[model samples]
Target: MKILFLSLVKVNSLSDRGIYTDLLREFVSQGHHVTAVTPVERRDSNSAKIEVEKGFTNLHVRTLNIQKTNFIEKGLGMLLIGRQFLRAINSNLSGEKFDVILYSTPPITLYSTVRKLKHSMNSHTYLLLKDIFPQNAIDMKMMKKDGILHKYFKSIERKLYNISDHIGCMSPANVNFIKEYHKYVSTDKIHVNPNSIEPIIQTISSKDRELIRADYELPLDKSILVYGGNLGIPQGIDFLIEILENVKLENVHYLIVGSGSEYQKLKNWCDQNKSDHVTLLKFLPKEKYDKLLSSCDIGLILLNKNFLIPNFPSRLLSYLEMGLPVLSATDPNTDIGDILEYNKCGKKVLAGDVISFKTALNELLSSSSKYQEYSNNAKKLLLQDYDVVNSVQIIVDRVEQVKFNQNV
Candidate 1:
């Protein structure tokens, strides 16, 4: 089968270790030809081009400054990305016949393109529902509810949902959100397809770990609680700062490593206050970050308290891959905490509750036996629930079923 993958994230090589890239590699290993289309947004460049890298074709469409930009610029870039992507696909892969058209969420502007592909080739369209849209924006107060922009994007989101032949949600809560609220969507179309990854083998001797800690200036004896992902509005930066300010401990140190709109806010606060317990760094390369992660004692997950949508953060997979226990502070709506608790892998606290957050940290710091148990559980949960090979098989089975029904 020939598969066409669409996403905002760049996946130039199968060797890339991430949620989508790993799945694309799995598709290839299963004897399918995969071609991915992703954007190459260079602020100074004013051209769109196609390139082939590492045995896959990529359409790098140049667009306005989209990611990690001001709201106005990001919104404008998102509005135009769909049409630009469609143009690139039509021009570059005119003769291609894709058996399966797989795309993920973020810029829900690709409904028209999916519709065109389905009409042109009779392809099976699948939505890897990663991020739910306009509602999440509204939850962050980035857009007003029922406002012109919100309504427009909401309409587009509906069209995208309708275009999908199968919609794979990030969790059971996410699946329920669509089934209960969006009455137009058929129940049979939704499936629980949680975030999955291809686990990597990372070995670091005690000497190597000590050297890595020394190089990064991380404390050798302190228990490091690391939060390594997007430092954006969705993370509820104010709440995170409040927790940091309130939780002053001698043995517990916080290390935040990522870049986003909220990064400057947290960094500026840390600098001005001379926060001793917190260390904030900008994004690092994947290799360095993974090593840094392995050295950490625990993983941290954050979500806005106001979110109506249930977000299952992909960073959990990284923590699990390293056998590090998780400590998540999220809204009640998200079931990330539920999963962690059920698997005995970690503890979860409601976001914005500084006292609960502090207590959870203290609990982890207080008991080594408990921490060791959680660490073991984290790795067990990863193998049981999040392996990419299992997710790939689910997707392949869905495609096969769709093909059988079509023939019948």
Candidate 2:
């Protein structure tokens, strides 16, 4: 099968711990051709856009002049990216046919490019619905329901949904929310395609882990709780600062390993609050991240309470694969909370619940036996369910099934 991926993020290597890479590798491994269409520069990258390729899947980075200095500029950039991508496809891929076109969303305004590519390449489109759009904006009070921006966003969102052959959501909660909003979309067509974690990097040994930590100035003596990947809108700086002020566990240090648009804001907040237990670091290379996560004691997830959407961050899966229990500080009704509770994979507290968050940490800190149990469960569940091999198989099988059904 020849698959074309339309993603907002651009990376050189296709083995990174995200949806774009996860699925790309899966297709390539199954002897399929996969080409990802991504931005000139990663919108999420705080440092610089790095091109990477490791096993089979190769990334095709598309350049775009994203004038996203401000909100209006950002909106216009998104519009142009989707608008311009269509032109790129029409000219470059008109002769090349694709078996499937996987389009991810958040900007939720890629109808022109996706629709054009769908017909131009004569491909079946799959909407990998990661975030709920205009509704998420409304939840954050960034936009209003009946406002002009809301209407415009909703318009593009509907067009994207209307044209797609399948809508794959990360969580059942999101599937439900999307259905509630868009009754026209058939529930049968909604697939739960989760954010999967690839296996841990096996090349790094215990000695290698020790040396890497020493190089990074990581405290190997104390237990390190890593909060890796993304430090932006969903995980607010205010909520994280409150956690630092509230949770005062002993012999445990918090290592936040990633940089985002809000990294400086969080850094300033840490300095102002005089947070001694917490340390912030920029995004590490994939190899280093694998080494660090393989050695970490605990992993943390932090999100604002206002986020009603079920956003299961891909980082959690990485934490689990390392056999580390999660300290999932997220919303009350998110997929993360449910997974942690059901799988017995560590503690979960509603976001902004400083008291509960502190208490949960205290419980895990005080009881070594309980911590071990949760950690073991996390590793067990990671092996059983969240493994990328299993997820990829499901995706491949399902795509074939969808194809068969379409034929029938």
Candidate 3:
């Protein structure tokens, strides 16, 4: 099977970041030929050209930057992206057939792009719902529900759902949301295929932990609480800082890893408010982040408490896979809340509530014995409910079913 995956995120073979590597390799290892396409950082007219990083012979990448100006970057980004993608697909399809056209939504307008490709190739199409748009933007106060942009985006979202051969949502609540919002869509077409973490193994380098601590100038005696990944609209940087202000104790240090546009905002806040127990580091290579996290006392997952729509962050699975207990602070209504409660991985705080977040942090940091108990339970849950490899086999199975149905 030749499967072409479309994503907005860069899945660099050089970086051990993001789920794309695991997802790509998983399909490739299953005896399917896989190719991926993503947008590159905006280029100047002086140096604008397509750059391809051929990691594997089967894995083909095409990079083009549509534009990089402040005005409507995302909306404009996809327009430029769509043009380049169609050109790539046409040239690459060169006498070969793509059995499945797989894509995920973000700019959401990609539906227009993918729909044409699906028709051109006459292939089965699947939507890997990584982010639920418009509503998520509303949750983050990025857009107004009654605004023209909202209605425009909603129309595109509906079209996207209508065209998918099967839509795999990252959380069960997301499935419910689709049914509620897009009531006309077929229920069976929407399935829960939650985000997962690929388990990692690091040789017990005694100093990897020590070097990480020293490089960050972190205290060796304090129990480390690491939050690795995007520090954007979802994570509630303001809420996070508030929690740190109230909860940073002598023996508890909050080590934040990863970067985003909001990274500097959080860093500036950190500097202004002298919180001794909080340390901020720019995004570390995943190998280092993963290794440091595995040895850390707890992992933190945050979603703005304002988001009522069900969301599941991939970070939860990563922490659980590392055998680290979580201090998850998010809306009580999310699917992650249920998982945290059911698995005893950690405590759930009200999304964006400083009091609840502080309490949860203190509870987790109260003792090593308490942390260990939660950590054990977290690992058990990972093995029992969230093993990515085993679960993703189910994903491939479903895609095969879509193929079979189309054939019939």
For residues 134-172, write the lDDT of model 2, one tens digit per residue. Answer: 878887788877899888888888888888888878777
Tens-place lDDT per residue, model 1, 200-306, is 74666889878888888889989999999999889988988998888888998899999988898998899899977888989998878998988899899999999
Winning model by TM-score: 1
How well does candidate 1 match the true structure in TM-score terms? 0.96
RMSD of each: 1.7, 3.6, 3.1
What candidate 3 gets wrong by more than 4 Å, as runs, is: 14-17, 44-71, 201-208, 366-369, 403-408
* C-alpha lDDT values of all predictions: 0.87, 0.74, 0.74
- Candidate 3 C-alpha lDDT tens digits along 72-127: 66566665676666676666556656777778876577787788888878877888
- Per-prediction TM-score to the true structure, in the order listed: 0.96, 0.88, 0.89
The residue pairs in collision within model 3 are: 305-351
Best by lDDT: 1
Q: After superposing candidate 1, which stretches have Cα over 4 Å from the reference?
A: 44-55
